[model samples]
Target: MQIVFLIEQVVNGLVLGGYYLLIALGLSLIFSVGGVVNLAHGAFYALGAYVSVQLGRHVGFGAAAAVSPVLVALIGIAFERFLLRRFYREDPILGLLVTFGLAMVAEQAIRMIWGAAPLPASLPAALRGPVIVGDFLFSRYRLLMLGVVAVVLGGIWLLLNRTSFGRVVRAGIQQPDMVAALGIRLQPYMTACVMLGVGLAALGGALFAPITTVHPAMGAEILTIAFVVVIIGGLGSFWGVVLAALLVGVVRGVSVHFAPAASEASMYVLMFVVLMIRPRGLLGEPIEKFER
Candidate 1:
């Protein structure tokens, strides 16, 4: 019985971790490539969820799921080209402030469009039921989410480690000026990074829409936790983000299962402990003068 309970908790942890990974991966990429904190990332996430729900209601679940991320990515590209690009050569703090303002604007815009109420978002019929594994039963949608996240992480890993674009990104992160001096246009790469980040955030929002309430303020609520994952995982390390997200998820999941009253506070506590021990984060590189 104890073993079964443990397995169940582990499954729950993975589901939560999958969502966290999706959000944190994008944040990590943006930070590493663009040096932007992107406070409005969660807003993009909420936008994706709202759009997905609306589309799902009109067209169909499959079609909505397929198109929502593309639309969100286009929005991200617009933000990158118009707003984010201007701040690339300026102070990082400026980008932070701009994104924070954008986040507020996005939240209000969502309110005006969707109202403050939570909307209904249902999973596809194919993923509506639970699957039994040994003595425990797990939600099919949760497992599907896990599989999607795994595939995404693997794809990202391949993109970063096995592709020429990855080399360019790494070089830029390490030496932006040198790359620029070599005649490389850093603007396009940065724009791509923003799109990638926002797309991942959108994906997370869409995936979680069926499980959680879809409200305009939902982004603000989850942004803090996503930031925590970024901090704990180390700002620019993709693998670190994944590991930290999983750790945070497990911590929160176990807390929810064993101490429901304290579940909400556990992630914060974990973040505090991590920061106290490793101020630079688990896999974060030290910021050099060039990076600044």
Candidate 2:
């Protein structure tokens, strides 16, 4: 029985890790391309949940989930064009400070518009309750979420590995000046990257809104863990982020079963240990612009 319970927790943690990947991958991508750490990234995530919930009141949950990220991606266009574009290739601290302030403003806006209370998001009755397979049990909704993440992951992998756009982005990460020398403008790519980053974050928020409490500070909460995943996975490695997110999830889940009190702290501990072992992070590679 104890082993069975442990297995269930592992599975649950994997699902949670999938959620973490959606945010961390975007953060990594934006930073890799633009050399800016987006503190406001979580703000987009909060917006996704709020927008989806509001949209859900009108359209169904499925439609709300689909539309919410698109709306947030539109906002990301402005964010990159007006704010982030200026910070690119500038001092890293300046980018951090500006994004941090943006995060504060976004949270306040949410408070003003949505109030401080948590909003309840529900799935359709057909999607609710437990799913059983053999002796293990799972949330029906979470299984669906897992499938969604898998599809997104595959789509992103294909985008980055098999496309011309991805080739330029990759070269830009390693040699922005060289890409410019080749007469390839990167502004469009950076904008698209930011849009995709925030869009992914929003998608995560929208998907998880039903299961998690939606509040103004929720962005901050997830941001901390997302950063943890990024740090553990390395600065710019896709597979690294994926590996780290799953590891963090599994660590936290195992902690819940064996040491419930330490569940929340487990990922941090894992981060600490991994950093000690590999300072650049597991699978983290060197990028030129970030070297200085």
Candidate 3:
């Protein structure tokens, strides 16, 4: 029974980690490639959830999930092109402030559009059951979430690893001046990265909509954990984001079994420990964008 419990927690933690992975990877990329501390990233997530819920009411969850991220991406594109591009030459703090204000405005806008009340988001019938593996029963929806993450992350990896644009992004993060000198032009790529990052946050929100309350405040609620994941994973480290998200998820799950209250603080404690022991984080390489 003890071993079974441990296994259960491990599985549950992986499922929980999926939530963070979906959000944090985007943060990592945006901060890495664009040098933008986009506090508004969380608001894009909220928009995704609200949009998905509203759309799901008519179009079904499949169409809702598929379209929500695209909608957020378009909004993100507009933000990056019209607003964020102007701040690239300035201090990163300005970017932070602008995005922070965006977050506040986004929250208010979400309240106006979606109302303060929590909305219900139901899962498709195919994802609404439990999977029995011997004596243990796991959530089918969660297992489905893992599959979804795998596919999405895989696509992201291919985008960053196998494409010419990926090479430009990689170089830009490490040597922006060099890329600019080569006349590669980074603003378009940066814009794309920002849009992609916001889209990923939105995807995470839409995915979690069924499991949690779909409310305006939900984005703020998840923002702290997302930042912790990025820091502990190292800014812009792909594998680091995945590893840290999953590790924190598992630790939180295990802590819930042993000490319920500790589950809440377990992630921070882990972040502190990782920062103290290995500042760059697991699977992270030093990037110039992370420097002051």
Candidate 4:
């Protein structure tokens, strides 16, 4: 019985971590290559959930999922062009303040449009039951969510590691001046990074909406968790985000099972321990920007 329970918990942790991975990775992408402190990333997340839920009623969940992220991504790209681009060479605090203000505006707009009530989002009927593996069972929706996250993450890995553009992104991150001097336009790539990050944030929010409430404040709540994961995993490390998310998810799951009251606190403890051991994070390179 004990072993079965533990196995079940492990699966649950993986699924939960998938949700965290989506959010944290997006934030990392923006922070790393976009050179913007995007505090409003969470707002784009809320926008995705709300847009998907509202649009899903008419067009179906699958279509909504496909559409919401693109729309949110466009919004992010626009914001980058209109507002964030100005601060690229300025102090990081300037970007932070602008994005923070944007966050506030987004929340207020959401509250006004959606009202203060928590809207409910339902899982598709096809995903209502559990999938049994041996003697253990996992929620079908959660399993599906996990699969979706895995595919998305894999695609992201390919995008960053396989393509010609990926090489440009990698080189650009390390040597922006050199890339520009080589006649490769970095401005377009920066916009692309912001769009990609915002879109991923939206996708994460939409995927988790059926499991959690579609509320105005949901962005802030999830952002808090995602922020911690990024900090623990390292500011801009891809693999670090993946590993830290899984660790945080597993920690939260085990804590919830063993000590319900300390589920979130467990992640904090883990963060504290990891930071003490390696100040740059598990797989993170020391970021001069962070030190500044």
Candidate 5:
């Protein structure tokens, strides 16, 4: 029974990890391609949830979820063009400070627009129940969320590995100077990268709104966890983020079951241990820009 219970917790953790991946993977991709640590990434996520909820009230849940990310991606285009574009090759600290400032501004905007109160979100009747698979129970909505994440993951993998756009993006990450010398403009690609990154973050926010309270500070809350996943997975490696997210999720879940007091700190502890052994992170690749 104890073993079964642990297995159940592990399964739940994987679901949680799927959510983590949605947010963290974008952060990693943005940093990998554009060399910007988008502290404001979570703000896009909060916007997604808030927008989805508002749209859901009128358009219904399915349409809202489908459309929210596209809306956020549009916002991302403007953000990259006007704000992030200026700091691309500047001092890294400048980019960091700017994004950090943007995050604060976004939070305040949310507070002003939505008020400081938390918004409650609900799923469609079809998605509100649980399923008993073997002796374990799972949220019907979560399984659906997991499936969506998997599909997104597959699509992204294919995009990066199999497309001409991906080839340029990959080259830009490793050898921007060389790509530039070839007469290829990377600015457009960077814009698309930001769009996709924030769009994924928004999708996470939209899908997760029903399960969690939609609040002003929710973006800030998730940002911390996303950073952890990124750090653990290493920056430029796609699979590293995926692995770290799942590992962090399982560790947190198991810790909650066995040692409630340590649940919150478990990932941090794991991070510390991993860093002690491998400072570059698990499967972290050397980034060209950062090398200098």
Candidate 6:
């Protein structure tokens, strides 16, 4: 029974980790290339969840889930062009302040549009059942989430490591001036990165909507955990973020089972320990310039 319980917790942890990976992937990409710590990321996620719910009601679950990320990605591109582009040459602190303000604005907008109440989101009928694996049963939707995360991560890895576009992105991260000197356009690439990041956040929101309540303030709550994941994994390291998210998820899941009171606090405690031991984070490289 004890072993069975532990296995169940591990499965639950993986499900949570999938959501973290989707969100953190975008956060890491934006940080790595744009050098911006986007506080509004969670806002994008919340927007996606709300959009998914509304669209789901009108068009069915499949269409809603498919459309949400694409719409959110376009909004992200607009934000990059209108807002983030202007701040690129400014001080990093200024960018942070701008995004922080944007986050607040997004939350208020969500409240005004959706009200303060939580909305219900449900999995499609096809994904509503549980799958039996030995003596354990697992939600099909969660298993689907794991598969989707794997595909996204793998696709991102290929894009970054295998393609010329990825080479330019890596070069830009290391030395933006050199890339600019070579006459490679940086704006488009940066915009793409922002869109990709925002899209991932939106995807996470849509995926998690069924399991969690969707509300105006939801983004603020998840933003804290996302930052913790980013810090523990190390800024700008893709795989690092993935590993750290999984670890945090496992810690949180086990804590919820063994000590419900401490479940919420475990992530902060883990962050504290990581900071005390390695200020740079588990997989993070030392930044030439400090990034928050």
RMSD of each: 1.5, 0.8, 1.3, 1.4, 0.7, 1.7
Candidate 1 lDDT over 153-253, as tens digits, reads 89888987899888888888878889889999888888888898899999888888888999999898888889999999988888789889998888987
Candidate 5's C-alpha runs over 4 A off are none
lDDT (10s digit) by residue, model 5, range 6-93: 9999999999999999999999999998888999999999999999999999999999999999999999999999999998898989
Candidate 5, residue 290: how far the Cα is off, in Å: 0.8
For model 3, how does the per-residue alpha-carbon lDDT over 62-178 read when each residue is reduced to its tens digit? 789889999999998999899888877679899999989989999998888778999977888888989999978899888887898999999989999999989999999899999
For candidate 6, write residues 1-292 as lDDT tens digits: 9889878887789778878988888988888877888889999999999999999999988788779999999999998999988777678888899999999999999889888889888877888999998878788888898998999889999998999989998888877888999999988889998999999999888888888989998898788889999999889888889988998899898998899999999988999999899887888876554543
lDDT of 2 at 247: 93
Per-model TM-score on C-alpha atoms? 0.95, 0.98, 0.96, 0.96, 0.99, 0.95
- Candidate 4 per-residue lDDT over residues 4-122, each given as its tens digit: 78777877887888889999999988888856768898898999999999889999998998899999899988988999889988888889999899899999899999898988899
Cα lDDT of model 2 by residue, 2-81, tens digit:
89999999999999899899999999999888888899989999999999999999998999999999999999999999
Candidate 1: list runs displaced more than 4 Å: 289-292
True-structure lDDT of candidate 3: 0.88
Show where candidate 2 strays beyond 4 Å.
Answer: none
Superposition error at 244 for model 4 (Å): 0.7
> What residue pairs are clashing in model 4?
none
How many angstroms is residue 25 displaced in model 6 relative to the true structure, after the best TM-score fit? 1.5
Q: Where is model 6 poorest over a 10-residue stretch in terms of lDDT?
A: 283-292
Q: Candidate 1 vs. truth: CA RMSD?
A: 1.5
